[model samples]
Target: MDYSEAIAIADDVHWVGRYDPGRGLQCNAYLLHTQAGAVLIDPGSMGDFPVVFRKVLDLITPEDLRYVVVAHQDPDVVGSLPVIAEVAPEAEVVAHRETARLLEHIGLRIPIRAVPPEGGFLPLADRTLEFVATPFLHSPGAMATWDTATRSLFTGDLFGAVGAPWSLFAEGAFESQLTEWHEVYMASQQALVYSLDRLMQLDPERVCPQHGSVLVGDQVARANAHLRTLRCGIDRLVSA
Candidate 1:
């Protein structure tokens, strides 16, 4: 599916991509517009991103792109970095320190700025971004972003699952969807738990994950508790 056609989730944020059911590889990318410029979070797989990138440029000129934040080094998340640089050369790539090093090791050399795991506040015209380091959730360099003004969290892979419909919420029976996807894709149950506990402290109102639908309202609370339970399950595994 062409992801360039963006779906507006808020005034300045859009979800660009196809969230296909039964597809293990599909995911979502988020576009954040600020007075300073625009930023894209986790551009998704190369095969699934070109349309979205082109569409983004149509809405906002490539030259206006200031940052392309890679929440992790996984190809599914940052695979399109090379393509992004080609189109938006002026934009500086942002990622955690470890992610930067890994990208370099793979010879994907692009100008990248490291945002620490503890947190780094980035000022934007509409809002400020607080990057929270969430190591071991899915990868060592995994991280998440919090938009303070909007109370939205751009959580990389956390609370995500396969088969998220394009409708912005998981379709079908919620429990069935969550259990199957979380258990299969989310390998680090303990890490998920730890991250959820920390994320709740941020008190975000909306969650935009790298995969699946965006969770809001009561769904957010349910997702949080599910993650906490996943952590407990991991703990049992360790004890056993």
Candidate 2:
């Protein structure tokens, strides 16, 4: 659980989260440095907070952390809100409208910048972060973030896979375990397809999911193609 070293993935973007094989699954949190500030995406579960923060601190101080982007309301996604709030006291939260409401309901007293149903963008001092709504893909308030500068997409749970900690960049074929997890968690086939189409349009160079390794290069396109035909939620229920 000691993810002491922060791995630099792209220009100013670092994978500063822990990878715990003991859990047999893990999530990735990223630190994106901007011109005047920094943004942390999906700070991760409570157990991951200490290690995540330690790695992140190497890149930027907690005080300079300006934005905490929550991709959804899932515990694995935003469970460390309290810890993040403590460290990045001045950081504003950016999430879907419903997610913002959930945060308030949970007694998280932080400034929220909600992304409307149609989705929107957050302007940092250095670049812009685009929010893409992917409702019911798993969570009703699920969303994905695209860093304009790095052309990297931070997908909440959209392209997640389950396995031992793998390569940071995805290689080879899409694991069967990944497709299986999606079949159970994604709320509906329609939602999955819709979100897939929208994300494909963005054509991100890298796809970073919360629970799995990063998908880069040709794997990004291949994964999207695979997701389009896969059935989930009600579709799987009927088939079952």
Candidate 3:
């Protein structure tokens, strides 16, 4: 795939993430073309900003960007957000209420829209994007975004992984890498289970995460099951 161009994930969505070498923590960003314009998700860090921004430019100009969604407040996900908001002043900042507080330190001004804790949907033109609050999976304000039209679930750190020789998509032994990452990075199995349960209800067609290969088709169910049973953080220690 051309690293400079946005790779199509679904009909109207594209993967604008950059894959860098030697970094155990890789990030993935996505772009969704809506009737209003482009919606950027997890714009990636300052290090990744150049590549991610170029990919977005490949599809549309900065003025077309409508919304910027940060799955969580992590620097890797929201570091590039300020630049995006600068370039596209019309774009609204969308995130869970808990995460919104941190954005203030970055000097981001109000009317920041908080996605409802239960779940909320953003209607742009004719298409709609939904947000599912996944508090404490990793952070209190952690959450995931869903594109209803494509059944694409943009998860934050909840389903992320780390490894070498990584393919863009989850491949052989991917579950082990994914499950292991969660056991170490996630706060607890209870938080993981709760979020997983809410996500499963969506029955997403594809799983787009912030820090790992994207999962599609059968891979989604398999990975979901693999992570659902693992004990994490304090739970892993207590069980041991």
lDDT of each: 0.75, 0.85, 0.85
TM-scores of all predicted structures: 0.88, 0.94, 0.95
Ranking by TM-score: 3, 2, 1
lDDT of 3: 0.85
lDDT of 1 by residue, 182-235 (tens): 665554666777777888898888898887677886788888876666632244
Question: What lDDT tens digits, residue by residue, belong to model 2 across residues 98-208?
Answer: 888888766666688889978998888778999999999788988999999999999988998877546566767766656877888898779988888888898899999
Clash count list over all predictions: 2, 0, 0
Q: List candidate 2 segments past 4 Å from native.
A: 1-4
Q: Between prediction 1 and prediction 3, which has the larger TM-score? A: 3
lDDT, candidate 1, at 146: 91
Measured with C-alpha atoms, the lDDT of residue 238 in candidate 1 is 48
**Cα lDDT, model 2, residue 114:** 89
Residue 89, model 2: Cα distance from true site in angstroms: 1.1
